[model samples]
Target chain A: EDKVVQSPLSLVVHEGDTVTLNCSYEVTNFRSLLWYKQEKKAPTFLFMLTSSGIEKKSGRLSSILDKKELFSILNITATQTGDSAIYLCAVELFDNNAGNMLTFGGGTRLMVKP
Target chain B: DAGVTQSPTHLIKTRGQHVTLRCSPISGHKSVSWYQQVLGQGPQFIFQYYEKEERGRGNFPDRFSARQFPNYSSELNVNALLLGDSALYLCASSFGAAGVYNSPLHFGNGTRLTVT
Candidate 1:
């Protein structure tokens, strides 16, 4: 079965600090890795990494994938209380018939305190 | 454009009852996927539909089924709902099935189902 594992199930940090969330996976025909931020309801998209070693960045959040290691990391710099949310990592893989489906990790809950 | 939209923000059901949840993808998007998220967990894939055809299904039981309409809207139906089935049903949309490599999924607020 395809599995995605995330480390440090929970974390607490002060505002302006940086945090790194990790995700590793084992799947067939991996295509891409995606990151999302979920607060109380739906999750919003963050970054999608299709290439290794290359980083995708937004304002304060960034992510990179390591295809060889089957892992990805999301980094948030200058974090604020608004950045507090459950960070999710998911891997998209092709099925036997070449169709795609996403397998998600357990997710890491982050708390940014002021 | 409105991102993805789901119906009935919250619902309460009893065990053995059936429930139907609806979703409308963003305008111009043709692919729709369903997922279930229990509290304190990541979303689990349920099904994916493209152009109103079933493209993929996940490890969910037969009790969980979904269909896409000609308009690209979708509905998720769960029969004999159990307490364990209570979760937030999420619907995501993408532009297409094949070229989804770099596309980020747009999600709905989700329908929160509580099975009593």
Candidate 2:
């Protein structure tokens, strides 16, 4: 079975604190890893990482995948209260017979206090 | 442009009742996918349809079924609903088929179903 696990299931930090969320996966025919931020309704896309070493960044949020270690990490710098949300990590796998599918982790709940 | 849209934002049904959820993918998107999300958990894939054809499916039971129309709109039907079936059904749309890589899925607010 394909499995994705996220660490520090919940976190509470004051504004301006830097936080790191972790996601580890075990799957066959790995393709890519993606991050999403869920506020209330729909989850918004954050980043997609397919390679190791190199990092993908968007403003204060950045993510990097380490395929060798079978894990990824998402970082938020100088976080604000608005940054409070659940961060989800998903691994995309491609099987010759099953095509492509995304397996998701339980997600990390972040709460930034003002 | 409008994002993916799902109908019947909320619903309540009995354990033996049946329900259908509708979805309209964004314009120009040929692929539509369904997912079920329970509270505090990540969404689980249910089915994927592209060009009105079944492309991929998850590990869900046969009781959960879905179909896409020629217009790329889709409907998910659940028969003999169970109390465990209470969840948020999400509809996502992408520009390409399931085999296409790097295509992000645009999701709708989802339909919340509660089974008694």
Among all windows of 10 consecutive residues in model 1 chain A, the one with the lowest summed lDDT is A95-104
Fnat: each model in turn:
0.55, 0.48
Worst 10 residues of 2 chain B by lDDT: B97-106
lDDT by residue (B9-77, candidate 2, tens digit) is 999999989999999999999999888999999998888888998878888888999999989999999
Model 1 / residue B42 / CA error / Å: 0.6
* Tens-digit per-residue lDDT, A38-113, candidate 2: 8987878898788898999999999999999999999999999999999999887875544677778999999999
Chain B TM-scores across candidates? 0.96, 0.96
The true-structure Cα RMSD of candidate 2 reads 1.3
In model 2, residue pairs whose N, Cα or C atoms come closer than 3 Å (at least 3 residues apart or on different chains), thus clashing, are none
What shift in Å separates residue A9 of candidate 2 from its native position after superposition? 0.5
The Cα error of candidate 2 at residue A23, in Å, is 0.5
Candidate 2 wrongly placed segments (more than 4 Å)? A96-98
- Give candidate 2's error at residue B27 in angstroms: 1.2
lDDT of all predictions: 0.90, 0.90
Candidate 1 positional error at A80, Å:
0.4
